[model samples]
Target chain A: MSAEAERDAPAGVDGAAPADPWRRGRWPVVTILSVLLVATVAVSFAVGVTAYPPGTIVEVLLAHLTGRPSTVARVDDVTIWLVRMPRIVAAVLVGGALAAAGAAYQALFRNPMVSPDLLGASGGAGVGAALGILLSWGSAGVQLSAFALGLAAVLVTYTVGTLVGRGTESTLTLVLTGIVVSSLCSALISLTKYVADPDDKLPQITFWLLGGLETVTVRGLLPLLVPVLVGLVPLMVLRWRLNVLAFGDEEAASLGVNPRVVKAFVIVGATLMTAASVSAAGMVGWVGLVVPHAARMLVGPDARRAVPVSALLGAIFLLVVDDLVRTVLTTEVPLGILTALVGAPFFLFLLARGRRAWT
Target chain B: MGSIRVRIALATAGAVTAVLVAGCGQAPGSAPEAPESSSAATRVVTDVTGAQVTVPATITRIADAWPAHNEVVQMLGAGDAITATVLIEKTAPWLYVVDPALREAQTVFTNSTANTERLAQARPDVLFTDKSTQIAAKTTELGIPTVQLGFQNYPDLKKMVSTTADVLGPAAQQQAVAYNAYLDDTLGQVRGRTASLPADRRPSVLHVYSLNPLVVDGTGSIIDEWITAAGGRNAAQVTGNVRPVSAEQVAQWNPDVVILASSAFVAADTGAQTLDKLRADPFWSQLPAVRDNRAVINPTGGWHWDRYGIESALQLRWAGKTLHPELFGDVDMLAETRSFYDRFLHHPLTEAEARTMLAAQDPQ
Candidate 1:
């Protein structure tokens, strides 16, 4: 860690301050995040099928990987391998990706209000998902189109923001464009709902909007995991650049960081992560906005420390919420509803504590 | 600083006071005096959205907004109380079977909310509805009490009969008991009729409609229970209630009896042509049920997802008998329909009207 710090930190640039308690370091954060990632994955697989136990989950997973069939009950096998296992994996990856993206957005725009959802990805994804239902697209096709449409929405937001005057898009301008784009997408979704068959199509669209992992198969999870990893890995590598960002753009530029290039990279990477997650999970809200704030309260506002913590916290938060849905109720509550119900009140409490933190 | 503390104290006190005031309504008051024993009149209670109401020991005037509820009201010997009802033509074409005189007495309500005021002017003692709907809520909030009843399942139907009877007084209790007995007997008959058939011989059924890609009944649903009782298998037992199954999966399952219920599709063309298209499809035609010509078309009238009363039970019997004529015996279902109308509907039907009603069902 010291060797890497000496390589990266300029000589005489280290100024230890009374206000900043500890110097931000990269290796420590990476070590913590790696530990958290493993723990979350383990927890995800551990949560389902109490009868079989966690050891049995490891064994079942190994057996499946090795092509050795077991005499397990088909329901147990299906629930563990087909249903619960994929969903658990999906939740962990998606949650981590969304959290990382949210942190990146906050740093890039130099505003905590900026998150992946600020670009209308979720809304556009919703419209695409509705269209899939309307056209009677198969499950695989539906998921694919949803992801594509989400990326398309962000692309439009980026293009519109950059095109107006300057090459760099201001935070306010990006937000306003997102709102407009989101409204247009929402209107299209409503139009689809208006003409949809009331019995079958309406329920499908409603359930999709509510956002649960019930329908996610291994096939759906695999393609989504690829983009999430691609987006997430780069964000983690460059996560140190985000800490300098909290010093404001002018200060960061003075510190020998190229603010424009860094901001663009982080924004695009974060948007990609959010789009991929939204497409697969179907508009799970509150995770991006609330998770980082939660991490800040837990570990304080150093991005080097906060980002990894937020990602871990986000993964744990979703995993527990998903478990509650599976066990707490006879009917599965939508993940979107569960997140909002829990997160919204907590957000209000945070706002009460320090309203300035919201901006 | 003292003022700030005082203000905070006041706010806390105000919240506490508000909570205490709200909590004060928890205690119950004393019961009202019981009515006279010698009156021989039935006491009817109503819950409607609006229109002033008066509870009486006997129902002198009734306003039936929902036609399915009107059938039960008629069956409970409260036909005289019914001053008006909505959807008479669509609900009980068989109403003429019981009392031909009810057809011409009065046209009390239309399908619009404007009719609420008109019905209020006519002055009804009770309003009847089948289950609570948005319209029922509006009418009840407007001070009109409705006796909501529907038979979507046996429990809901039993509750409807019992609740309606409780408010309809002594005469209704007798009718309720009789109706309950009739339902038991019919269910028993169905069980007995299907007992001898082999499990494999039981027909696999599918309910198709335009509203969804694929819709099927839940295993525990009344539709599944009735289908099983009739020696027919519901294809949806594998999935849960009205779930969206892929079209390819439906083709693979290939149910023996395809029952289409969407009014939207029914209005498209002759029901026969629609059935023919399904039959002609290579995947659909490959099913064993389709080759045997076992597709049965359900008639229009009292076709609802939630209403499972005596009328709905009869409809199930009609489907069973039509699908399995050899097992149920060669009975005229129209005659059965006529008797159901006569017993439960306030209006009498002519033979011509009965034919017209049945003909409207669209195998044509």
Candidate 2:
């Protein structure tokens, strides 16, 4: 439309500027992301497998990966295989999914507070999980019910938000819808608690909502891995388009990106990853909201690099926290409590340092 | 951002306070002093939770949702004061015998929310419930005088019974003395009969609940006390009152005698079908108890095992018979049941009632 715009245009029909290729200065961001990712993984393994030492961890992992028989004891094998491994894998998947979802939500709403759980997914998952326990359905059935209910909650949020608009809802409307849906779900959860057998069922319901990977097994890990991979991979791969869309809907459309389509893909992909992770590990909190910010601060706001970096950091963050919970106290600390305790303080420190950048 | 900082600070302070309070709130020093007898004018005054109302002179009516307190009230001769019971355990047989009029008291709701409403409606002068069994803060706030009765283990039962006896006054006090005598006598009989057996010959017993997989009563349970008292070895030595065990773990323990209470066994009709299912299962059949034909199923008693009172003692006696029937070979359990009923239960159980209450034959 302007003379400068015409001059900068890609030499064709009406002089619209072609989309820029991945930013030329992204290499530094990429390097920083790799460093953070590796560091987080290193820290995760360092905290959890403390009994075996770092060298032993490497040897054990190498042996397992290479089809060589492990020298670990049978009891340790059960502990690592049935308990810790599934938990660590689940943490990585959940953390990555949640952080990526948070990033997508923030981009969609153009607000800092938006996270995957903001859409009532966690509350719905908790209620469904509580119901599953009350019904005395064994382990697998409980996880399945939680995931189904989480997806249903997301679907409800999306539908209600859409009804408030012509085709697509704005970030504010979407958030409002999520709050209402979550409140409704929470009320139902309370009602369930009221009727539940106090001696057994209520305790189970409370424990599920508190969130833990205490009983996660390798068999449980298999089903969640598929959806997490499917959901997280494509979103990270398409980060370039995601970055453009973050510039605001009108600007993104003027630049030839279909804002509606991108939003849908990101939401669905992120929701699937979140639902899968929750079904396996319950409603672990804070990593999604905090990890993306940490990633952004470490490597600037380039989605291509930030997505993977956030995923790695999230996995690493949760693993270390979980290990702390198991080893630090005689009783396992609830994952949600630890996350808030650790994440909230770290976030505040980050905000203090990056006050100018944030503004 | 500032709000987040505030939340973090507040949560940190609150969590620290909670941990500190939890730590400090142990030991008898932290608990309120027990209410003194009205008959004694020199009774020491103490801080009371809202539910602990200091009556001017007399306590006419009382309601107890916690059946553990029933023996205490009965022992104090305050049967007339009890207007309602939260739930009844017919398996004890003695509760009916001790006070036939107790059966006529109104039933209070068991589910928590309704229980609260029922407490208000009952409006008794005093309410007895255990800290574990009821919401103390809310109940106290509802303007009812509440007392905490301990039931952490079997010994706690004697303490609760004695405490309630003191509060209930005279007539119920006589019942308490008789009940205690009965307990000592019954326990004495079992102990005397089995004392001659060598330690090596002592039956190792395993109690299983098919309803909740791997749940077995352990150290704090009356079963543990009964087994030890009856000269049998408890198989659940390393576990807690309610333990999570895998089917593999149960088989590996290979208890000398396997027993299932009616409460623990799934409420299915076909005994042969149940036995066959157990025998056919790869995991369950490997148990030595199963192979030796030592597994027995106690008849259904409803939610009777939920409390540890005289009912618990009776169940223990029944468990002792099931575990080592040969120790008392000439002891006719049917005749023993009726006699025990007449002496402890006070009410005569009809032949039909007696048959239905203890009819689950040995599954092995």
Identify the candidate with maximal lDDT. 1
TM-score of each: 0.50, 0.49
What tens-digit string does per-residue lDDT give for candidate 1 at B216-318?
A: 5546556676777777888764533455567676767777787765332434555566567767867667767666776645554433422234566565666
lDDT of 2 by residue, A63-84 (tens): 4444455565433333333334
Q: What docking grade applies to model 2?
A: incorrect
Candidate 2 per-residue lDDT over residues B1-364, each given as its tens digit: 3223323432342343233223322321112222343343321111122223343235667777564456556545565567766555443344555565677665553322113333444556667764322234334534445565655455555555655654554554566677767766777887788778898978888776553566776665666777776667888665445555666666566788876655565555444456666666676677777766777665533224323555665665676666677776666666666665565445456665566556643211
Model 2 misplacement above 4 A: A1-50, A53-59, A62-67, B1-364
Residue A176 lDDT in candidate 1: 82
User: In candidate 1, what are the lDDT values of residues A60-159, reduced to their tens digit?
Assistant: 5644554454554433444455555656766776776787688777766667766678788887788888898778675666677788888788889878
Clashing residue pairs in all predictions, respectively, total: 32, 11
What TM-score does candidate 2 get on C-alpha atoms? 0.49
